[model samples]
Target: MAAIVPVPVVDDLTSPGAQQSRPGLRASQSRRLNAFRYLVFALAAVFFGLPMFALFRMSLLGSRPGTYSFAAWKQIGTYPGLLGSIELSLEISVITFVLMILLLLPTMMWTRLRVPRFGRTLEFLCLLPLAIPAIVLVVGWAPEYNRIERFNLSGIMLIWAYVILVLPYTYRALSAGLNAIDVPTLSEAARSLGASWATVMTRIIAPNMWQAILNAALLSMSLTLGEFTVAYILGYNTFSVKLVSISRNSNNPVVVFAASAAGLLFTFLLLLILSYVGRRRRRRRA
Candidate 1:
């Protein structure tokens, strides 16, 4: 008689601790936080979601000016450059996402995996914008954004500003992703396996934190999309500016409400997808 058993192949990249600490909230914390967290989330739901709800209602019912109809959304679809503006804004956000990954990937590996000095300094540099007043940033960039001599006064300025403003949040999301992975062990093993630094980073590191990357990218995209002050200051009137302008016009109030509702709905859907991704990542690890 013989018994058959499957043999598991071990990759040197996995630390014993890696499987032990897959980043979903621990059960004890979940038990403690479930009610409190749900309460907090409910309050946040009321706070952020209510205004958008009002906007939707305003679009549909306010003024009885027939403004509450889906007509506004239809009209928005017909506007010249409207779709282009949305596409262009997305391009900028995606660019920012790529640039951030370029900057973050190595820095995180160096800090957590390679144990490099000055990593904290760079991290601090990335986080510096957190303290800068939005108004001040707008003021600082106002003149530069509209430069005639530099030949750079265009959509790029908008992209750069959104990217800059969103850097802190993006960095934290990605760095937390890094913290959740077995950076040192995986990287060292990859090195041992004759994988180059680039391969190790692109393959080993990124795939591990796909959820975090999604979260960061989505967060950056939403932030950039909704950013108002920078667009106003930069004179780069994209969707947000146009929305603001529409809101300002008493006659187009319905259009404003429709736009706000569409925007909120889109953001919430994107966040839901991100949450699903995080949950999936945890399940796969388990």
Candidate 2:
């Protein structure tokens, strides 16, 4: 009678046999890490998606007899002032975004090139907005906005106010992009090649910092679209103000739910597209 016995293979650290197992061990570790990453991603998706699902369900609520429906969603068009509010929000967002780029890009580049020391001062001023509450800023501008009404300009003040609100974010984005490149060197090279300051900024500097520019513009647009306090205090019927007004007056959650869901969807898509484009640009550069 014979019994079969197992023997362990002890790998010596300096042995070629041990080196052969290294690849297998590393591969196993990689697989485990990837599995953990996927698990975390799935959990995060659920964490963020659950509320959106609940909101969507609410948007479709009261549509039928114990049946889920989207009648409320369709009624978004019928909602009073809904379309006008959306249009005003879009107008402010677009105008503010344009002003952010035009007003900031040149000044940022000029500061970096002409007076490097003032760069910190500029950044400090930009961060000041974060320190001041939006309500306080709105209150301070109340008198000026009142005067704006005398001129019949109305909500146009919102565009300028939004530029101030969006400064902190857009400045940081532009500063990060500027810090990545040598501004003085780029400017000198462009000038030596017969480029005007305008040409240098528009063609040379802007192209290099396109990502920052895009980020700033999109961030400005996002902020403008979601703005409320200033618009409300100043008596402008921007989208967010209208949403709150409707929710307060109608006491119907459906319109609120529908608008929120639509806004969330739009924001998500905008961010997703930006992320994809940035990744593709990085890949192309690499």
Candidate 3:
């Protein structure tokens, strides 16, 4: 029997003309995608940048028409309790961040390591606050504040409420971080090496999750600083509460706008810093 030789097959789609058109087709698609990306970026810039510009411009407006001054900005410190409210808000932000990290980090790590099955339930509980309206939360917290006031804690009591409000954001950030790393493997490795739980958490897990921790801290602090409803309902003079009070009581509208712009700028700076740090961390990891 004669063995027949196999014939080479060529796909029409891969013919010379088809091959020549493919690069042009890909180039066109690339151009369209880049254009779409630019369009999206422009829209985002307009959406976020416009309000911030208006706010800052309003803050700079002068008493007379067609004039501008920094008088309002200068007078931000003069408003009664303004500085104190800012200080109080900062304190609350710091305390709330610390408490949130201490309470949630350990619990989340343990749950992920020991009871992976309960992760969904744990996430649900953390995110439950997002479904609860701020006003409703305030109503529920009012009674608790009454008891807190008896101890003469004043504005400091807002820390607890702010922590609750920040939970959903903090949890999402931390959960993402935990998922990014092999928590169970790391924990087990550390344990096998005779490292205590404290050392494992601090020296091993915490370092790996720094980005997520920073994100959680930023969210907690920003929420604490900007929160109004709970603090107002609880009769605390937080930064946001004081901003409202100043807007209502002060004749100078620019002053209120100035304070608002300052707060917005500060939050923006925090975000910028977070972005910078995140970039640095990624570079280092790479």
Candidate 4:
């Protein structure tokens, strides 16, 4: 006869005690998770908020020691060509955004639908700008811009370079939107229902990816507004270039800091709006 062996019994998860404990365990985990999230948020606020606060405070510093005044902020308009440079930057931003949408949207959609194999190549070309320094890009573009100058297109020429500079950002944004949806299925279904390519793009696809498009547009505009290297090297006075010029030329350099702080605040506001809009859109869709 075989020797009798003792086996350990497993705890039954369905038992009343075990079932009652699970809710308590989950509640404890939820509390811990909420606490951790709040801690991370507080840390982030301190990290970002402190620098901005310092910048704003420094911008308000007066000429005398321990004095503070808003004169620097008010005197921003006194600087020659400062307003013009701002206007030029805004024009470049808007035009660059439109061109990016027109150029990238169709190409990306068509490529995804017809020539998916070339997607990697296209992505590589779009991302090539990130690897090449702005100075190097200006060197390559100088000759072409010189040619363009003969046509009397002064600041307008910057639009071409701006579009290329913003490629990596816009491409990534559009790619994220594309990846979130079934492009082929959507395209085929629309086509099967007698929808034209234009209809498919403008009506079916573009509407669904508006958030990504808006994100790309805002990024392109922000980059254009803050871009210094390409515009400076190419001899254009964009917003960033204007700020640099003011810091170097003005006796009261505090004004430049004030303007910079204002620009930063504007960008932050745009980001906040983007977040709010995205959240509202998601809720509506849900």
| Number of clashes found in candidate 4 | 0
Q: Report the lDDT tens digits of candidate 4 across residue range 1-286.
A: 0111111111111124644234656787877877897999999999999999998998899889899999878866776787788788889889999998999999998898889999999999988887876778889999988998898766867989888888887888888888878888999999999999889988999998887788788778778888888888888988888888878887768877788898889978986677677777776887
Candidate whose TM-score is highest: 3
Best by lDDT: 4
Candidate 3 lowest-lDDT run of ten: 1-10
How much does candidate 2 score in TM-score? 0.84
TM-score winner between 1 and 4, please give it: 4
Off by over 4 Å in 2: 1-43
Model 4 local distance difference test score: 0.80
**Which of 1 and 2 is the better model by TM-score?**
2
Q: TM-score of each candidate?
A: 0.76, 0.84, 0.85, 0.82
Candidate 2 C-alpha lDDT tens digits along 174-274: 88778878888999999999999889888899899887777777777777888888888888998889988988888665888988899889977986677
Q: Identify the runs in model 4 with alpha carbons over 4 angstroms from their true place.
A: 1-50
Pairs of colliding residues, candidate 1:
59-68, 60-68
* Shift in Å, residue 69, candidate 1: 2.8
Model 4: lowest-lDDT 10 consecutive positions: 1-10
RMSD of each: 11.0, 13.5, 13.7, 13.5
lDDT score for residue 105 of model 2: 86
Give the lowest summed-lDDT range of ten residues in model 1.
1-10
TM-score of 3: 0.85
Global lDDT of each model?
A: 0.69, 0.79, 0.79, 0.80
